[model samples]
Target: MRRRRLPATALAVLALVTAGGCASSPPPPPPQTRAGHPERGAQLIAQYGCGSCHTIPGIDRADGLVGPPLTRFGARSYIAGKLPNSDDNLRRWISDPQAVVPGNAMPNLGIDQIDAQDIAAYLYTLD
Candidate 1:
């Protein structure tokens, strides 16, 4: 018996139809948090010099003994040993540590709301 093969163009069309007719990239990851960008948060962390007092896993020069290590900040359940480890509290701590916990070593970095949100988003990614 003799066999016949489909033409290249026909095979290409078949491939497309079999593969859902068109190619598309995957859906983007859901927003990490409301109005928060983890990538930007990382940069902001570095820019604000948070690494100078804490040991962050992904940022360079983030090793410091003054503050507790943040390698697993996402797993933590409290900020400054007082506030709940919720996103809001994290943002509050980042924006005004002194306000959250008076006489604490963590100083107020004057981080804006949006920046604080982004930083919180990044911190949550540690897990």
Candidate 2:
């Protein structure tokens, strides 16, 4: 029989993980971004039913477990942990997830560039 003592930092991280669950408490309504309209993007997210899969902050009824929660999307350096999180890359991913990663869970949703830009803008506000 053996028991290993977890480091304090590791225990703290574990506590945060267990406590936070998926996302932080709902954030204030999203603000605007330089690339596109965040408000419109929020609307588009609702219209597209993106909340059906992801736990997006500030989006009502966005409590889903099928996909990763976008708690601090703007702070993330990568999109889907692959593509760099640049505006162009984000827009590309939003437009067609399969094209970028080939087997990602996020579907294309037939979103155009304009809408993709707005969605990206809104996502960036999650930080």
Best by lDDT: 2
lDDT comparing candidate 2 with the true structure: 0.86
Q: Stretches of candidate 2 above 4 Å error?
A: 1-33
All-Cα superposition RMSD per candidate: 14.1, 8.7
What is the per-residue lDDT of model 1 for residues 17-103, given as tens digits with 9 covering 90 to 100? 778632253323333454589999999999999899999989889888899999888876667767667777888888988887789
- Per-candidate Cα lDDT values, in order, are 0.82, 0.86
Give per-model TM-scores: 0.71, 0.73
TM-score of model 2 (CA atoms): 0.73
List, residue by residue over 1-127, the lDDT tens digit for candidate 2: 8999999999999998778654345333333435999999999999999999999999999877998999999877677867667888889999999998898788879999999999988999888
Candidate 1 clash figure, as a count:
0
